[model samples]
Target: MMHSFGELVTKFTSYFNVRHFPMAPSTLYDPCEYFLGLGGKRIRPVMCLMGNELFDKITPDAYHVANAIELFHNFTLIHDDIMDKAPLRRGMQTVHTKFDEPTALLSGDVMMIQAYEYINKVRTNTIHRILTLFNKTAAQVCEGQQLDMDFEKKETVDLDDYIEMIGLKTSVLMAASLQLGAILGGAGDSNAKHLYEFGLNLGIAFQVQDDYLDAFGDPEKFGKQVGGDIVANKKTFLLIHALDVATGAQKEELQNLLKQNEDDKVEKVLAIYRSCGVDEWARSLKEKYVTVAFQHLEDIAVLSVRKKPLKELTSFLVQRDF
Candidate 1:
C-alpha cells in the first residue's frame, strides 16, 4: 500500500502546502497546517489510487482525486473530534484541542472547499457523476455522525439501526472512493456498482473487526487503550449481543453499570460481556461480514489477476490487529 502512496503523499502535501502562503503567522493558517502536518495513515486516498489501478494505469491526476478524498476525510475528522470532545487523534493533539473550537471549525470548512477545488480538476465529462456521488456521500456521512450522537442519548438501539448507522458513517465513503476511481478509470456503470458494493461490504466488516479488537486485540498491536468502548458505554456489537443473550440479572447488571459513575467502567462492562459470550459473538459477526465482503469482491466480474490486489487489501483489513 505504501509503495505508490508514499510518492503521492509527498507530491500532494507539497501541492497543498504551496497553496498556503508566506503571510505572517496568525490564528488563520495555523489550524490548516496543524491538522495536515499532524498526519495519518492516508488510507482513503491510497484506496482511491489502488481502486483506479485495478482497471487502468496509475495517473498523476489520480493523485488529485485521491488528495480530494484525503482532504474531505481529514475535514470530517476535525469536526468529529470536536463533537466527540476527543483530545487526541493519530496519537497527537486534536485540531480543536490544539487550537480552539472556532479555528478547528473554520479549518474544517476550508478543507472541504479545498477538496472541491481538487475534485473540480477531474475530467469535465466525469465531473457531474463524481460530484453527485461525492455530495451524496458527504451528506450521508453527516447523517451518520448525527445518528452516532443520537445513539449516545438513546435508551435502546436496534440491530438494524446500528448496521445502517455504520453503513452510512463508514461504508458509504469507502464505496464512493472506490466508485470515483472506477468512474475516472473509464469503467462502465455495472463495474462501478460492483466495486462500490465490494467497498461497502469491506467497510462494514472493517468496523466489526475494529469492535472485536477493542475487546480481544493484543494491546501492543492494537494501539491505544483496549476496552475503551466499554468505558464509554458505546453500543458496540458486544453490548448489543450481550443485551440479547444476557440473562435477567446480567442485563440488569450491564444496564446498572452504564448508569453508574465509576473508574472501573471498563472492567465491569467487560466482565458482563465475557459472561454473556459477547466477545465470541462479535468475532463471529466480524468473520461473517468479512466472508460476505470477500464474496462480493470475488463476484466483480473482473479478470482474476486484476482483482488480486483488492482481495489482498480485503484480507489485510479483515485480519488486521492494528
Candidate 2:
C-alpha cells in the first residue's frame, strides 16, 4: 500500500515538528526553532520521502535525510532573506528582521551544521556518495546566488543564462533531495539519476510558474506584493522575454519602467509584457518543462501506481495559482 501525498506530508510534518534542537545558547537556537516553526510547503523533504518509497518502504534513513534537507533549506532561506532585505516569510517576520542580523547569521550557520549531523545519522554504505552530492549541490547553490546578484546589476540577461542560474540555485537541491532518498532506498544508479532529472525538470517548471505568478497572480492569493519583482528590477523570465521582443517605444518604456521607483510601475511593466507576448511565451515555456518532467517520470522503470503520488505532487506544484 502506498501513501497519498497528503498522508506522506502529514506523517513527515508530525515527525519533523517533534525533532530536538539544542537548548543551550538560546539566541542562536531559538531563531532556528522559530524559523522552522513558520510552516512552508515542505515540498523538498516530502519529495525525498516519496523518492525512497518509490523503490522500497520509507525507512528511518529516509527520515533522517528528509530532516537534513529541510534544515538546509531553511538555513538558506534565513540567509537569503537577509540578503534580499525581505521583511516577511510565510506571512511572519523573517529571522533577520525578528531577531538581530548577527543572530540570524549564526542561526543559519548552526542549521547547516545540524543538517550535516542529521545526514551523518544515515546508516548506509553509500554515505560518501550522498555527502559528495550534497556538498556539490550546496556549492552550486552559492554560485547561482552570486550569479543572480550579478544579474541584478547588468542591463541585459540572456534567457539561457537565467535558466542556468535557476537550475543551480534552485533546481539542484530539489534534484539532489530526490536522488539522495532514492540512493538510500537501494535504487540503482540509473533510476536514481532518472529521479534527479524528474526533480530538476519539475523544479525548473515551478520556478517559471513562480515568475509568471509574480506578475499575473491575484495579490491576495500571492501572499506577497504582486509586481514586487518588477519593482525590484529582478530579471525574471517574463521580463527577459519582454526585453528581447519589445522594440522602439515599447523597449524605451520598459527601460524607463525598470528605472522608476513608483507605485504604478507594476501595471506599466505588465502592459509592456503583455504587448510583447511575454506572458504567452512564459506560459508555453512553463508547460514545456512540465511536459519534460512528466516524460522523465514516465521513464523511471517503476509501476504506474508507484509513480502516482509524485505525479500528483508535480501536478499540484506546476498548476498552482498562488
CA-only RMSD, every prediction:
2.7, 1.2
Q: Find the candidate with the highest TM-score and give its number.
A: 2
Candidate 1 wrongly placed segments (more than 4 Å): 1-25, 261-263
- lDDT, candidate 1, at 161: 95
Give candidate 2 misplaced runs (Cα > 4 Å).
Answer: none
Question: Candidate 2 overall Cα lDDT vs. reference?
Answer: 0.90
Q: Output the lDDT of residue 258, model 1.
A: 87
lDDT of 2 at 48: 90
lDDT per residue for candidate 1 within 1-322, as digits (tens), equals: 3234455445545655544322335576678767888767666776787678777876666777888898899899999999999999888999888889999998888889889988988864888888899999999999999999998788888888999999999999988888888887777787788788888888888888888888778899988798888777788867877887889999998899988769887788888888888777777887787777777777666777777667667767778888
Error of 1 at 304 (Å): 1.1
Judged by lDDT, which candidate is best? 2
C-alpha local distance difference test of each model:
0.80, 0.90
Clashes of each: 0, 0
Residue pairs with backbone overlap in model 1: none
TM-score of each model, paired residue for residue: 0.91, 0.97
